[model samples]
Target chain A: MTTPRNALVPGGAADQGPASTTPSGDSRRLIYGHPSLLAERPTHYCPGCGHGIIHRLIAELLDELHLGPTTIGVASVGCSVFAYDYLGIDFVESPHGRAPAVATGVRRTRPDAFVFTYQGDGDLAAIGTAEIIHAAARGERISVVFVNNGIYGMTGGQMAPTTLLGQHTTSSPEGRDSSLAGYPIPITEMLALLPGVSYAARGSIADPSQIGKTKVMLRRAFEDQLGGGRTSIVEILSTCPVGWGMTPQESMDHVANEVVGVYPLGVLVDRRAAAAKGA
Target chain B: MTAVAERPRLMKGNEAMADAAIEAGCDAYFGYPITPQAELLERMARRMPELGRVFVQAESEVGAINMALGAAATGAKVLVSTSSPGMSLMAEAMSYMAGSELPIVLINVMRGGPGLGSIGPSQSDYFQATKGHGHGDYRVPVLAPSSISEAVALVADSFELAARYRTPVILLADGIQGQAMEPVMPTFRMPDWDTASWELTGADGREPRVVKSLHLRPEDLEVHNAHLQAKFATITEREVRWAGEQLEDAEVVVVAYGTAARVARTAIERARADGLHVGLFRPITLWPFPSKALAELAPRLRAIVVVELSAGQMVEDVRLAVERVPVFFHGRTGGMVPTPSEVVDRLRVAWALTAPTP
Candidate 1:
């Protein structure tokens, strides 16, 4: 509906234009087809890291939601440092742990525009803890793609806030001993109980089917943000193969089996009923 | 026109800066209230909404600066003002803006700091101002003005430079300069804004443009850095500005910048009255810090006295410009401004020391 006249290929199929009357026709394929927001460049995420899959799913969701060009992606520092390189939309590279604050500015200024922060565990849960908490507490109408891989990836496998108990990392070389390091942070569960967040869920890209399902959940979060609900976060149980010293498949299995046991996946807070009643 | 004369008056430097920001078409101002510059935030809060702009006190210095940087992405002339510690907190955003080349205006009403140094005047950030504090090889342009009038003029120019060069532009002034009320000509100039071709805001009908700093390949980052260096080189060519005082039959030249420069005027008179044959070279722009003008004075003078509020930071630049031609320096550290008499005393010592040197 927001398409300009000249965007269409000249003299091609009129059915292949944005003005297509049907949402389920060839014109719909033309309108909602192609990867409009995924960068043409190859991702540099280490193998088995689920960042690549999450990036693709987010782009696909944006295309489906018809919010690609208008969506401003805040790419936080960490493994997703090159996220700007992979996202074809307008991307603002955020300071470490400052993505939520930056996203708040974007959403508040451009209320009609779709704004989201793509952050890693260290960025969202550590130094950026206050930022994420305050933005969530303020009920900023922004979405966050929180990729929690259980261990810090980009910075030589340091102990992140999400580092699971008994997990061996560069910082916790003897493995995250519970008595020494304390328990893993159940971020989504903790945030979902808060009043500000409208939606909070945990999902993973352990397999292709789960990847497909995660896309649907991400779409819901984005829709919730667009529909004037409070802020939301979809925590992706990502894999860090290089840091974990395992193959990508093994890492995916690790997330599906080991990681999800600690960080359970479910909609912790659903404000749909509240939103609908208010409306 | 009858109503024009009846309009309200009595504005401070911070108030003038806010008015200039509004006139320059800045759509958003995100800042925290720090004394000597608090009125800037207050004025914005009052005026931004009436002019159909946005103003918000960000959670912290870090939050405010990042918010301004975000506003820059949508092609807004976003600005943020801060004191020393606050600017130090914003060090990361300064580097981000410099590297990403998003046009932003960062005003530093500098206070004392080697830590939470003081709430009073200091030029300790001279090193930080010229040197991009966070990370990277780019220098954010530093505009040092001596008065409120220059603060307003330089702000408009800062936005223009940020857009034209795609970098963060700093309007560096100390607390005294920020707090003092000076007569400013309320003149406004409208910059020709054609968003039809900016890299951000989707570039509309133009070729796709990228606004980022990540270059994985060595060759790519190297090329980007070289291109930026060349741009700064061009900036040096066109933007080296300063105010020169008497040099006819003079053997001593006092070098200063910003408020220190204005203070040197009185010291220069005192020194000349005492028959020391002294003059002044006041730097208007600090990063491109009047190297050519100072270098030109090296051979003619027996010595150059670099005066500042810090422990001789600008002296290094003078030495770089003049190349060890009996360079004498006088400065005070930790939130203390060098009084005119202190500067005069330094000049006397400099002339006496260098007079007997060769």
Candidate 2:
């Protein structure tokens, strides 16, 4: 069976550059290559950090879609603030909790240019609650790649708004108490209620298969912008090994087991088909 | 061919600046409604979309300023207007803009405020605008206009100054100016600002660009601050603006700005008609303070009486400008505006105090 047009096919995009032969001089076809849009440098992210996988997925999609030339990114104030450093596109680093507002400004000023914001759960659901809600309500024609790792990893794994009720974080050493800290925010489901949000989905980067599924949702969210739809967002449940006090492999397992239970992975909102039916 | 100037038309200060911002080639306008300056946001909401430009009445001042920051990063000329409390809300984004060196124009229609003080006219924000605008070692150009016509002209010119210096520029006025009506010639040519080298359009056929203020390394931050300081020094040398009336022969000078300056103007004239030599020294640009010009005139005057709608804020700057010049101050705080007659009484006391001993 043929794969989808926007699907991530190993390293098969047109912009993946040339294939390399083996050192033995055998003419073998290369099945995988680095994404040309991802910069070749050591990232500051800790080992087992899911930011690398998510970044690669976005870079691959941007390269495959040839969107690198016209994409403007708004990088948030968390560990992904340096997402701009890895992506080959124009970018602006926004103040803490202001990425959605900044992206709204960029998209409005340059409607022809594709815009996206990479933010963390703490940045989006806590301080920037107003900005995210309003941008989604306005149905800004931009995409959002929200990495919800359930903690503020950059600030030493503090309790974020999406932290699970019984999750143990640096700030919640005795495990989170819903009595005081409140419950984990189901932000994606809440945002889907806005008519401006044409697409909203939740995905996980727990394993290779899950990463592939996440990429599919991300592609739909991004492609929705090209169709001039309203704000499209894909919330990615990620792993933070160092922040979670787990080994790299254990972190992956925890994300696959515990995180997904809290943030159930599925397409929560898809208004494209509804729009088509209405039309 | 000589261009015919447009006839001056009566307009409120808030609406006049809104029209002047559009005329100044503002590509986007983002603002939140606040007392005294709500008309400015309303005008932009109506005019900008009609002109095929961007306008957003943002959810709050925090959102509005950030939107302005985003638009400014994309090389769009942006305008944001608000009164005192709203300006207070914008301080965080202002600090970021100053650090990132994004050029945008902000109009702060001053009201009495320590904490939502009152909507009446006041110059209490003189310190806030000129000194501690935000939490940073950065300075934004502050222009104070005493009347609606001057506010129009200053608002138009503020865009160019912001672009030229690559810094945020503030048009600091008050409720008196915002609510007052005067005939203004909203006719000015938009200046050319070449932002090709730094603006974030896209990475099309070029390396990706980052417009950011995060310099993680201390050495790198030092270099960035050095660049900002050098720009501020250049602005201080080149952009000091002020106006003087009857300074050639004056025994006392009333130093002030914004609405306070308007009151000082009338009081100065009244003092002169009474055969006492009193002049008005009005600072148009309050950040660069116009210290040199005031210092130059210090030797000719026996006393300098600084007046304001706030409790002697700009007077400290005046004292610093003319050292040991018998500086006196008169002010009314908490939404109370000083009348010309009250200022005249202060000027009389200042003149008597400066008289030769015994």
Candidate 3:
């Protein structure tokens, strides 16, 4: 299964160091651009948020994979709710938590289409819990770009199912105690346990190097959908500057120092070996 | 087109609908059997494969409509038939298809509802059919046919509407209408498809296109919604359909739709026997609802009684249309269908009180 791959940023080797990879001198700082399939606009996420970076990574992958023609994005109600506007791909606004269900319908019907869903912690873990789990269990051929931003971002940061212990949010103003909140649910771990899932990975955009790697994994998820295999989810650890009541830079520091410890990033499931076996 | 030259035969409304769907080149039929309309699925299960179509007996109504959407995205003519509760299950998938602008047909042999309601014929989903059947700022073209023959014609029309509008189209009738037999002379035939405009024929002949409803920018979203609204506005102008009977010098006009409209028409004719001046307003397209025609009739009539199987749903439209013309309502919820005589009696009682013996 050979495809024509066209890299958007020439491997990102030039993107090195602490000040953060700024796309290069006079090359336009807007990470995701016109040629990248995303609609150019100020994202609806908080300052220093990972959603923007994640969107850029996905956009860059869409360009590289040549999935623009077949790309279909299912938008759910969350911080990534306005993803459709940015991705500029064909989109379907799914009901709260039903993005997976909607994505399944699109994938099953348009099997040739590269179908992916953009969802948040609450939208996936709570309201749309059944749809995502069932879709994964059924091994529906679709990709989900799940953002576990710890706290719900849209309606002022509330304690999400993915919110870590002692993390403070609007709903959990007094730090989230594990006993009262009953522990943060690691969605990737839960989903990976199911045989239906093909890939499950968590990544944060706080660091420049990790963001580059996140794009590679995101591309892999979309490839799984396009190749007509099993379900995949790339859970993104996003940031909340306004919700956390800090300047954008401070929030990035918070994700690097505080949030990273609780939600350690890694691949929970990988079916690449099985994919190789099948081939 | 007439290779079969098939002789006209008496058939159940639901079965005629299924046959018409097959004749319209429907590529797939997905459904789970339910009371009153189960025979329709029986007919499809027998004939679909022979016609080179996919007929799947889905695990549930949820699965059935989802399958229909899957088949429809490829621009395959698809139909899913169900009763009331099954329709409620269908609502979620229906909204998704509508949002994504996928064309598919839904044949709703309506029963009573709220819950487990009734399997018997009821025009109770008028509100749901006209409204909540699809979520968001979108409209489903709901077509109502009274007789088996109309079901044949309406099913074909629904597929056409679904294609033309790029939205879900409901061949919305009830159990009574679904099971009734009537004379059907196949007038209009299914047109050979032209997928040049819209249809996911895939990346074979041209560049691959993705149909989705994700709008991230507020301005872009506003533009998309406006574009959809414009299409709807065009729908209202070109798609509105209804028929009026004996309105000239009549004392009352009975505004009804679907199975209830059929019953109301019979009652209107019966009342004429007793020399009561009565007319009928029957809506064929319940969504762009024959409002203009009804509004025009409002000035001349004494009053309007919205006869339905549900609790006065379409009556709200009548009230809006006839503002100060005095609107009266008669309905029975949960599977109750008023007979011709019952309707005549209601009309007589209303006639006596409204304009008196003239």
By TM-score, the best candidate is: 2
Model 1 residue-pair collision total: 1
> Candidate 3 chain A: minimum summed lDDT over ten consecutive residues — where?
A1-10
- For each candidate, the alpha-carbon lDDT, in order, equals 0.80, 0.89, 0.77
Task: Put down candidate 1 lDDT per residue, A66-111, tens digits, no spaces.
Answer: 7766777788888887776666666777788988888776765676
Worst 10 residues of 1 chain B by lDDT: B1-10
**Residue B312, model 2: Cα distance from true site in angstroms:** 1.8
Docking quality tier of model 3: incorrect
Where does candidate 3 clash, by residue pair? A84-B216, A85-B216, A85-B217, A91-B212, A91-B213, A91-B214, A92-B213, A92-B214, A109-B70
Selected candidate, larger DockQ, 1 vs 2: 2
lDDT of 2 by residue, B194-280 (tens): 678898888898778999999889999999999999999999999999999888888899898888988898998888888889999
Cα lDDT, model 2, residue A244: 89
What's the fnat for candidate 3, on a 0 to 1 scale? 0.16
Instruction: Name every residue pair that clashes in candidate 1.
Output: A166-A176
The digit string of per-residue lDDT tens for model 2 on A30-123 reads 4455677887776789999999999999988998788988999999899999888788789998999999899989999998998999999999
Clashing pairs in 2: none
Best by DockQ: 2
lDDT measured at residue B32 in model 1 versus the true structure, 0 to 100: 88
Tens-digit lDDT track of model 1 for B224-287: 8899899899888888888878878778888888888878989999888888898888888898
